[model samples]
Structure formats: structure tokens, C-alpha cells
Target: MSYLKFDKTVMINLEESLTREVLRTNRKGAYHCTTVVDCNTRKYHGLLVMPVPAIDDDNHVLLSSMDETVIQHGAEFNLGLHKYQGNNFSPKGHKYIREYSSETVPRTVYRVGGVIFSKEKVFSLYENRIMIKYTLEDAHSATTLRFRPFLAFRSVKSLTQANGNVNQSFEEVTNGIKTCMYPGYPELYMQFNKKVKFVYEPNWYFGIEYPKEQERGYPYQEDLYVPGYFEVPIKKGESIIFSAGDSAVTTTRLKSLYEQEVDARTPRTSFFNCLKNSAQQFYFRPKEDDAYLLAGYPWFKVRARDLFVALPGCTLSIDDPVRFEKIMSTAVPALRAFMSQNSLDPVIRELEHPDVPLWAIWAIQQYAKAVGVEKARELYADFVHEILEYISGQKHPDMKLMDNGLLFANGRDKAITWMNSTINGKPVVSRSGYIVEFNSLWYNALCFYTELVGGAPVEKYDKIIKALDKSFPETFINGYNYLFDSVSGSTVDWSVRPNMIFAVALTYSPLTRMQKRSVLDIVTKELLTPKGLRSLSPKSGGYKPYYVGPQYERDLAYHQGTAWPWLLGAYLEAYLRVFGKGGVPFAERMLISMEEEMSLHCIGTIPELFDGNPPFTGRGAISFAMNVAAILRVVDLLKMYNAE
Candidate 1:
């Protein structure tokens, strides 16, 4: 039995299967995303979506989907599914699906009469290519296969119609055809391993509806162009490989390339292995020396905060310290460039976020713990010293090191923290001034940097450390025992948020053991859910638990009462910090509860967040890097505790 297998019952039911999506990505920022039944429910869902830097920054969907038809004895079975207008599905290929499994690569088995065929999809690990292998398991007589390619050469954020501007002509390649729908975009080469016949019948598929988009109050219908079809014959036990990519490839090596890619995949056999596999998917390497961790799948770009926050768990937790060093080596220079020259790297965005530098230091602290502090200091001592000086010296435009030894950020207009949902150019949750997490991270970074490079640097910031130790507890701790979310001069937001968990979770915290216990207990009581920790306590006013509805409504509720799985890393760390061996069982149970999520919304991967209320439904980005990384970190932590 496969770890992520759906039987015929679930496969045939549209309601159960359509909600479950599968995502595959390459290191070069190309992705293949669709539902389990191969139906695209969102505009982001596609067969080949990749970044077109020549056109723009956003990812463009070059190949929307491929419709496959199985023919036996001149009887054709159209094995392709598409949701049309009026809630209708065309071709209705999902009915032929006998089973869907994603243990290694995503494979779907189909049965038509006596014929049993399977389709396995593999995205090339290092290139912008997708390969599909069709195997005929059992057949009664001679069989033929036809593939129709759907083309949508537009940004994933926008849709296209039947435009006369599109160039319909295609050029012949090695046992294939290459077409470029528009200028400034890379030509997509679609090749088959074996000889096939290409019929050039250019037509537009109109009124294809994306229900996921309609539900989100966006334009849901669009037109996709079909560039004819490819026909080939197959024997009972024969397998044919089809490849689609931006560049042309040798037809003879397609099968060998597909096999090599499959051989390198890590099987999602268990909960931890599943997460580890998902973690590796976030890694994006556009250039030879440059590397980054994408924030999430389908939509998000490479964000600085997300990259740092997810780097350690995504790499270190998977027992790949070399990858961790590779990514950090690339990011540290970018961070320095931004700090000194105010130059943001084109690939990694949002470096100016007030808390990004702090999070970067935290990620390095994790690396320090993994490979002893001495080794980390030898490598990152200067970089760490530079970041600390930049923050404490008040070089950061958005963040200020105040007299009370806390970093104060003004989030009235622009969102400065990770709860960065904005509406009409203003932050939905204006967490300005002395934020609990910012100060906590600030104190932690200062302590870690000083500890990393002792002697002079330690003496230089000794008074500031003492000031934070005294002012942090007095300023944030309220009468309710839990720390305030933010303190703005005389005004205070007393919402019980998970932000305070960092105070106890950080390697070096300003809070006393008793204070840590109080903060952790409050978080566990009000914000903790089976999914993770809620952004805000439900008892607080303006708390909206469900992250649904239109864009505006969703943004309003995004951080109000939404439960974030990423926060579990901090909450669990704080739990172990306060309770030690006694908290291991509870922590284990919490981690076990997350195993159910591996089979949920996106198989073998965690979603960005969940609804804060019961039946904590997964929401937001289907496969989030932060959430996956956090879970992997917890798994690593548990292993260490068990060994002890």
C-alpha cells in the first residue's frame, strides 16, 4: 500500500478528489499542479508553469493541460477532465481512474474494458521540464494513445482569450513540435520518446471554469488553445515517455531522463519522510551559485523572511547540512548587500521587512546548534556582527532600537511583520511599536551574536542586554499574565497571540522561567489548536476563525484568528524549554495529530494555515514551506529528546 494512495471510491467521486491537489516542482522554478483527478480547479493549476524572466517576474502557464485518449479496436475513450461553464465537466476522464498514488512520483491507474493503463508524472529535478510515462499494464488487443496539448501563454495571475495576436504556427523538432504562443516567451518543446503523428488543428477551448477562482470571487472562466494532438501506438507491456519543456531535448533520451529523475526521488513512505520530501520541493536554484527557498507553492515568490524561517528545518531537519550551508552562503551576501548598500536581490524580495534580519539570525542560531557554535562563528561571525551593528546602530529604516532596548516598528501604513496582510495599502492588523516577537527576536539575536563572538562585542552591548532584560517583562506582561501583543507608547493591544511564544522559544530569551511558563500556558489555552497556534485568541474581539470569502474578507481574517502551522515550531520549542522531558508525550501527540494532515488538502505536504475553529480546515497556499519546515523541525527536536 502506498503512503498516499486514493482508491477507486475516492478517485471517482469529484467532491472528495477534486479538493485534493498534487504539486510537483523543479529547482528552476517550474511547477506542475493539478487535482488528483487531473482537473485544474484554480488558475494556478497547470501542467507546465514556469517563470519567464524575459516577459515579467510572475510565472506563466505555457502548457495548461494535456488531454489523453486511449483507443482500442478503433473505440476511443477520452481520458481527460475539464470543468466547463454551468458546472459541467467535459470528457469526464476522472471516471476512468481506478487508483491514484503519490508514494514516489504521482501515478494514476485507469481501466477501460480489459485494458489497464497507468500514467506516471515526474518533474525534472534540475530543469524546467515535465515527463509523463504511459504504461499499458494489460490489454486485450492493439492499443493507441492520443495526447492533446492545451496552451495558455499568459501570467498565472491573468487569463487569456482567443486572441488574434497569438502565433499559431509551430516548428518541428526531434520527434516533436515546438511552439511559442507569444513573443518574449520561451518556446515550449513537446517531445515523445517514440515516433508519433502530430495533427495541427489550432482551436480555442472557451468557457473553461476554475471553481477555486470563482469561490475566491475572481474571474473564473478562460480560453485555452489546443495545438492539435499527437497519436502513437503501444504494445501490451510497452511504456512511452512524453516530455514538455522550454528547451528541446533528444527524443531517444527522454525515457532514460525520466527514469533517472524517478530514481532520484525520495519515497513518501512515512510521515517524516513525506515532510522531508515536501521540504526539498521549496528549494529554488535559478542560477548556478544562487539558491533560495520559495515561500510556498502555486502562488508565492521567494521571500526573505520565509526563506530564512524555513531554511534550517527544510535542510537541517532532513540531515542535509551541506544544502543548509549552500543556501545560507547565497543569502548572507544578499543580506549584507541590503544592509549596507540598500540593494535588494532580484530573486529574494521583501528584505526590508523589519523582522527579516532578526529571523535570519534565528535561522543561523539553528545552524549553530546543528554544527557547534565554534564552526558557525568561523563561517558567519562577520555577517552576524554586521547585522547586529546595523540593527542596534539604528540603520534600519522601518525598525528603530529604542531607549528601552527594544526594536519599535511602525506598521500603521505598511505591514512590517510576518502577519503582513494589507488592505487598501494599510495593514489589516496594525501591529506597530513594541511587538512581542520583534523584541524577543531582537534580544535573542543580540545575545546569540555576542555569544558567537565574545570579548569586545559582549562588553559593547552589555548595558543594552541588561536594559532589555528589565524592560521586556515590565512592558509586555499584563495583568492577565500573558504578554501583550504590542505596546505603542501608552496604548497596548492585549490580544493573546502566538507572537509571545518566541520569548520562550528562542535560544536566548529575555523572559524568566516563571514568565516563560505563564506565556506558554496562555498560548496553549487560547491560541493552541490541533493544527497549530492561532494568530489571535478567539476570546479577543474582531477574531474571525475562518479564512474564506472574497479577497478583502480573507485578508481581514488572515491573521485575526487564523491558525498557523509554522508557529508550532516555536510553541513546541517553548513547551520543551519549560517542561523538558515531562512535555515530550504531549508534544508527541501534537506532532502525531499533524500526520493526518499529510493525507489532507495536499497529500504529503502541509498547507499554509488552518481555520482557527473546530474542524480546523486547511486553507491558503496548498503546500507552504514554513509549515512543512516547522513540522520537520519538531520531528528533529523529538528525535533528540528521545535519544536523551
Candidate 2:
């Protein structure tokens, strides 16, 4: 189920616009648990500030029993209240509130005590308190908000709440939120191809915050006296109300405003759906992620899935030839390093994931098909020599393999590659035989190398392929059920993760149809949740449900149990591999639901993961790359396969 809309009690002044807005969490909103936007602006600055003892309260949890909604609204946010008693002046400003630049934009901007928010003809205006009212029509709505500075911008300072009075004088009233975040002058920090960046600074304080999460706020560069603020529980499709003396007027007026305007809009065709779907592909995109993207919002590493999907996934129709080439451009380097490194010693190699997999050879062949055989061979020649050098190293005595070939102990965490950890906090899911995904990638490497350097590479690479073919079979658990992360000496025995989906989802894998079926069945049965695929089975003790919070706990929570919606594309791909290809709209129709739901939040993206239970708790995330990238590729697969 999605999140519930909250009825927030927002505090404002004489000069502020009397407008209201509903708060929403970007990702969780999909599951009906939406977050909210601040009134002063369409978007609010996300800061994890320390609480001032006065305004701070206990953690507030929201639960609508009948609706099956549960939300943890932490009390830490309310601690931002600091009393400003220093400067006193004749409070010239009458009212202060936030309003939007124009009615054309539903997203709002805040105004202070002296702002005027108004609407035009054919629409009723609710300008009683602060000249704030709205009217929506079928096509579009138009409105304007104007802000006037407080009495020549009087020496502003935090004042004590004179009993939380709304009509108190500016200097006497403990009001005015001092946020570096104030659209006060909300400015953009950086402009990237994909995202818009804005950095928040405290007006009075000089502190450098990583601005990461709530717990992550440790005095970094400078320890500015940054005080935190409280959050109100707000809901969707409803208005928030706050008043000191006249409760009846505020309610009666707001209700009248809603009833009067609700009838005017001939037909409201909300674009929430359009907003969700349009952000998926290369629509309106000025620039796409390079074939190799060094990420900021998304995590690190050159993602194989992201790149592969981005090529045909996002851009194939536009620059079909060039973008596809760009996708494979690094395939050569990635393969060469992989083979060389693994070839150094049988025990030394561990593979990540692959785009085309065995089809790397085929993808290369396809590249040749698109460009020419000469270009393909020429590109192959660029990196094949490194394989020989790595082979020399592998043949050496001192060259040892990590974890006897199954896993490699890397970093203090002992993680092997990216998907190297388990819920127990053990870094590598070290196991016997090659991981399904790893073997798939390795096989692709061999096939790709053989395609590049024919004679010697075919023979040499063939021998290694034979070893993998042998080791992989031995690794499969006829005794238990599925494959683990890797195969070497001691294997990580548990976890039927969705990693195998890639092995099947890849253009090709070394496994036979029978082998792929068994693995896919195990994953589908145990790991596949409705939202996506869970990291662990709910039936297992190791299972941890996904939610939000502090990192160390969150990381442990991240992969262990969270049902990642992005990973669902893998399942969609694999399912189509055997069962649905010849069928119409195999993947195309499948994504429409996700596109529809996800577009509700991130202007054009999907969340990192969702709750692994019924009603699918979508929380603590928004606009993750894997989600968008995977959809891109999966949609491409549907389009391409359908064309075929």
C-alpha cells in the first residue's frame, strides 16, 4: 500500500501567503506513503539538523489501521528551534508566507509576511487572511504570488515563540525560520546533464555538512550553529491548517475555497501519469549518461547493466549505430582486463556482470554487422594483447587466487566485487563453483577474446572455458538447490538471490536451458516479490525487510531483504528469454505499470527499492539510476524482440 497524506500544522506570519501544500515522500508515495513539499517552494531542502531541546519531541509514527499504513516520522527533525532574542525593531511587515511565481506551475515557492498570492477572473479568490486561493481547470490553471520584504528587511533574528501566536509582532514573535534553504533565494548549485543540484547553506551559521543523512551530520569543515526544525505529518489531496485566535474562520474559509473551485475545472486530466512515464526513456534529454558514467546520485563503478541498457535501452532509435558502438567500446577493455586478471591464476579471477554475455562475441559480431567486420576486428585488436600478459602472470607460481576461486577477500569489508556481501555482514557470499552471473560474464569474456584474436586465443581461451564449464557444474547444488555468489573452496551456502536472473537475462549465458530453468524457478519461487525481487526469502531467518534510516544499519538492511523494483526488470528479461519472446508486448506492457506508478514522484525516475511485503512499502528513495537504466534496456528488449 502507498503512504497516507498528512494534515500538517505549519506556522506562518502576518506577511506570509495563506497558501497550503501537501507533503510527500518521493518514492514511498508509490506505495501510497508520499512525502511532502514545503509551502515556500515546490521543493524543500533536505537537511539532517540537530534538534533544539525546546521544539524537539519524540518520534512520531503514522499508522492508519484500516489502510495498513505504517510510517516512522522521526522526532529528530523537530529539534531545529533556536530562540532569537538579540535584535528588536518595529515589525513593519504585516504577513509573511510562501507562494508560487505563477498559477501555471503547481509546484510552489514560499513568500514572507508581506507577500500577495492571487488568482484571475472566472476563478474565485480566498484572499481573506493573506490573499491566498486557487482554482484548477481541465486544461491548466493560472495564478500569481508576490512577496514583499519585511519592514526594510529588519535585522532578522530568531525570536521566542510568544505562545506560538500567529498574529504576534515580528520582533516580539519567535518566528522566521533561518534556513540557508530559504527560496528566500533558493539558487541552483550545479547543472548536470541528468539532474538539477541545489546546495543548502545556513544563513547565520558557517558549517560544512556532507548533507548526506540525518546521522551523517558530524562537524565536517566548520561547525556552524545550525539549529534543526520539526516536521508535521501532511497528507495528499488535503490542506494543512494552523491558526491562533479564529479557528472557525480558517476552517470555514478553506472549506468554502475548496468547494467553490472544485466544480470549476471541467475535466482534470492529471499529468501525474504522464510525468511518471516520460522520464523513463531519452525524452527531453539534453544529454545521456556516457557509455561509462561516473555517478554522483547513483553509486560508483562502471555498471554493465546500466551501460548496456542505456545504449539500445535509451538511445538505439536516435543514434542506433554510434550509441551501440559506444556501449561495446569498453567491452574490449573490460574483457581484456577480466581475462588477463583471471588468467593470472585460476584462483585469481572473479567476474562481475555482462551486458550481452556470450553475446559479447555476438554483440561484437552485431557491432560488425552495424559498422563493418574491419571495425569490429580493429576494435578487438586494441585489447587482446593484455590477455597474453595476464596469462603469463597466471602461469607464475606466486600468482594466487582469492578464496580458492570462489571468492576474493577485498577491502577491510572483505567484499569480492560489487554484489559480494550477505546479510550476516559477511562481505563475500563466498561459495563453490562460479556464480551464475560471474560464469555468464566469464564465458562472454572467453567468447569475445576468441572472436578478437582467432588462433591462439581460441585454443587458450577454450581451455579456460572448459575449466569454467567443469567448475560451474560441480558448483551447482544437486544436494540443496541454487547457486551461490561464487565457487572456489568454501562456498557461501545460503541465499537464492536474483543474480541468476542476469545469467538468463543476458543475451546469452554458458548454461543450458534446463540449468537456467532450475535456477530461475528457485529465484522466482523464493526471492521474487511483487514489487521486485527480495534480497532474501521471507521464509528464511536471514531475511530483513527494507525500510529507511541510519547507514550502517541501512546497508545491512539494503541488500539482505529489501525487494528492489529495478531488479524486477531482470526477472522480466529472464522470463521472456524462455517463456514469452514470441508473445506480443512481452516486456513493453509489463513496464507500463511501473512507469505509471513511479512517475508519480521522481520527475523522471524510480526508487532504489521497495518494501518486501504486501502492499509493497516504497520508501526512503527516489530517482535511482539502476531503476531508470534497467527500464530503458528492458523496454528496448521488448521493442527489438518485437521488431524481430
Candidate 3:
């Protein structure tokens, strides 16, 4: 992506530590954040979490701490510390969502440490004071970092410690002042919520009160907005650290942390530093052997195979290939586990529960193909055996749904479409009954298995693929243009959507050029957005703009109308097929720009999703493996394009 098209205020560099950046968005969606860094601990720190002090209407500070467990909110009202109390079941979004505005403050303190040289960050919580510490030492000297964010009481202030509650409301606390000293290092770390607004108040204005203050060595630092730099004042082999959270003190003791720097000590060190710190903020548990670090976070967990759709962009390109294997291998057992539980159709891996749509399998096979053969042979064998079993059950001699060409999933409501199936209350199989995307997934999986294995009649799979190809265009044809959303004879849903793209991105089984063009034309005209292809049309009743909010509402916002960045991979693949690939081509430019913009969020990693609007902001997953996996595939494609 060229600098011109990629230009958008030069935003923070993906390569620099959060501490080294000039400005970052603070919690509550604010636009300004000034940070400080402690080079010894390698842990970053922050002050004034956000503009407006992150006091939401709910009367709670959203402690969106990724690594630390306790969010030590500095209390105001001059009555000392007043803790809000309430209990809210986190949808696991707690692993990622920094509800810097939750109504209650858990009595437990939040503490997360950043490892300057490790792969993961430590997050823990306690009461009263929150401290995060990291230590690393070589033969010469040991480097230890400890950050303590504590409650500060003003001199002669009349106040008492209050009870903590979760349902507490937001209240403005003082723009506190507290000074932490590391004899050797002074580049204190600071991390305010990036979603909030902040301005660096002058450091000189706050350094008062403490009589022994003017004796320390001068703190070397830089003013980060433009070209500036800051240095950690540690011995060549020693380290220093900083503690975060809104520490309380009268405005007199606020430390000087306003500085930034570009250029890295080592690409690998800087790279790992960012991931290590961010990791402290979220949870991604891989079942011992997954291809990606983790495709699951907070709530919306997906299948292991689904993660491959975005792998190469993850560890393959930038990280070690061996680590990538750990991620890929995880799918083997994941699939087996998913299939083993149910006997009705062993091949069906319940995509969470009740029904296993073929689309996920579609993506998995594609991922395997992308990974190449030797690395995926066992995966293929298991996949085929199960698929062949499924085919045996479903292919009623005539090769159709159940005993005929009807549309339904294993006796469920006929609307077994991927868009609208509900199981145990959770909306499963949404937009049901012979949905085009589902069938596309179905048809492609069949053809792919047939191509790989030498068991069933290859012609049988070929014929089905051909049949679906011909049937789709005609059955879905809408006279003037565009294909139907599904062929259960259901109406087109009257909403502009990008479900049709699957027919284009899928391999083997089908889609004619004109049909592809038609589908592409419809989507380009309606579904394309700055972030990604919108799932449902705004004109549709179900669409909802994504915003920070309560859980259910947020989940509803997801996919219902939210933009999915992962879809950009699908879109890019489709674009490559339609316009031919290569960065030289104009289409490739769009793709590259898309990649550049995405990489900016995590220094080259794709976000899970983005806002479904212009200036479409990437949201949720920071450094999510699945999303990055998709971008990696795109990168691979770009390379392939270049080779061609």
C-alpha cells in the first residue's frame, strides 16, 4: 500500500512499544493518550485512564486491563477511597473488553505485568493496591520491574474508606498526582484506555509538596507527538519499572511521563515486547496444539479449523514455522473432539452445538490446501474419513438433502440455513433453509474431499459440483441481476448482503464467470464498506450499528450488521480471482491498502472486526490470531501475485 493511500494521520507505529507512541486512544473511546515507559521492567504504565476520567453513565470505570487483574481506580470526592460494588457475569469479553465504565469496582485489585523479554504477560488482582512486576536478568545484572498504583489521600483531608460495589456509578476523581521512582530508570510507563481522550498536563506544574523532591537526577525524556525520544536512565545492564492505574495524590506529585520515540533497539525485541504486553490483557487458551495462538477470546469462540483461514498471516510470515504447527495441529484433535461426541452424523462437528454447518469445513479444507500437503496429510485423512462417512449418510443414492433435493439439516426446522438456526436458545443456523452460503459450503466440501481422496466415485462429487453451479445461477437468478440468498424458493430477503461472495472465494465446485461477476457487482454496489463487507443491509430490520454496550446487545450488533475484517480475506481472494492479483494492479493496491490499515492496529496483525461504517474503526481482538490468519493468507496471495 502506497503512503498516499495508506496515509491517515501517520497513526501510531505497529512496531513501537505502547509507551513509545506519542498519542493513543484512551478508554471510553477518547482520542488522546500520553504515556510513559519503564525500560527496566519492560512494563508500560498510564495515568488519567481517559478524558472525562472514564466516568460513564453507569458510574464505573471500565477497567479494560489486558494483563493485570485489578483495576485500582483512584477514588475522588475528597472523602478518601470510595469503592463501588456489584457483580456482573463477564461474557469472557472481560478478557478483551475494558469495561472502563462498569458500574462496580470489584474489591480485588487489578495487576498485570509486561515482560520485556517473555512471550506472555502476568495478570493478577488484589485489594487496595495493585502491583505488577516483571524480572529478567543476564549474567551481568538482574532487571526487575514493579509497578504499584495506590490510593493517595490529600493532606488533612476529611474522608474515610467506603465500601466497594459493582453497581457503583461513575464519579469524577481528581486528576491525581503520585511519583514513582526507579533510581536507574525514569522513562515511566503509562497506558490509558486508547478509546478515551487525554492531554499531557505539564510535569513541572505537578512536582511539588515532597521536600526531598528536587534532589534526584534529571529525568531524560522526549516530547513524543512529532520527532522525539526518551531514554530509560538505567545502567547499561540494569533496568527500571513503573506502576499504572489512577494513583491518588494531590495534583502536586504527578510524575513527568510525557515523551515518545521511534526506531527500535531490535526488531524482534520490540515485536515481542508489544505482543507480550498485549497478551497480559486478554486470554486465548489453545487446547495444547492449535495452529494459531488462539482463535478464541472472551466469548465468541470459533472452531479450530476456522482459525486456519487466517494462519499464514499470523506465525508463518513473521513468527516461527514450528509455532505455526502447534496452532495447525490443534485443529486435528479439535475436529475429532467435536465429532466424537455425536453419533447421529459423526462427520458433523457441532459448530458450538446442535448443528455443524458445512461452511466451517469449507474454510478448513481451504486452509489445509493453503498449508500444502506433507504438513496436512493426517488432517486430510481424518477429514475425508469423516466426510466420506457424512456423504454415505446423506447421499441417498440420488445425492440430495435427506432422501431428496429438499433443504433441511438432520430433521431440524427446514430453515437449517447458516444465518438462522437456533439451538438451546442461541441463534444457530441463521437465515435458514437452503441458504446459498451453506450450500456453497456444502458443495465445495464435497468436491474438495473427492479431489483429495481416492474412495468414492470422483464423478459423483464432480456431478454434484456441476449441478450446484448450474442450479445456483438459475435458481438464484433475479432477472435484472443478482443471485438469491438461498434456493429453498425463499425470497431474496430484500437486503443487500455479501453472502454471495462465498460462491466466488470457494474452490473446485463451481461458479461461472458471469455469475461471479454478477454476484461481485451486487456486493460491490451494496455490501462493501470501509471495514469489511456488511453481513446484512442497513435497510434490513435486523441490522444494528456496533457500539460499546451491554453484552447481549453487543453480540447482536456482531454479524447482524457489524463489519468483519476477516471477510476482507474472503473479499481479497475474490478480488484476486476477478481482477487478477499483484500489487502492480489497481485492485491489489486496494488490497494492500486494506492490509496496511489493518496492520496498523497490531503492528501488522488484522483485527477481528471493524465498525460497519466509513473510517471503519477496527474493534475487539487486538492481535487476534484468526483475524491475522486471514491477512496472512492475503499476504501469501500478494507474494504469489508478485511471483506470477
lDDT of 1 by residue, 192-291 (tens): 9988999999999999999999989999999999989999999999999999999999989888899899899899999998999999999999998888
TM-scores, all candidates, are 0.98, 0.53, 0.56
RMSD of 3: 15.4
TM-score of 2: 0.53
Cα deviation of 67 in candidate 2 (Å)? Answer: 34
Best by lDDT: 1
- Among all windows of 10 consecutive residues in model 2, the one with the lowest summed lDDT is 60-69
What does candidate 3's lDDT look like per residue over 562-619, in tens digits?
6765676677778778777432365455555454542254342345677676666666
Return the TM-score for candidate 3, rounded to 2 decimals: 0.56
RMSD of each: 1.3, 15.1, 15.4
lDDT of each: 0.92, 0.38, 0.39
Candidate 1 wrongly placed segments (more than 4 Å): 454-457
lDDT of 1 at 164: 93
Task: Report clash pairs, candidate 1.
Answer: none
Q: How many clashes does each candidate structure show, in the order listed?
A: 0, 65, 80
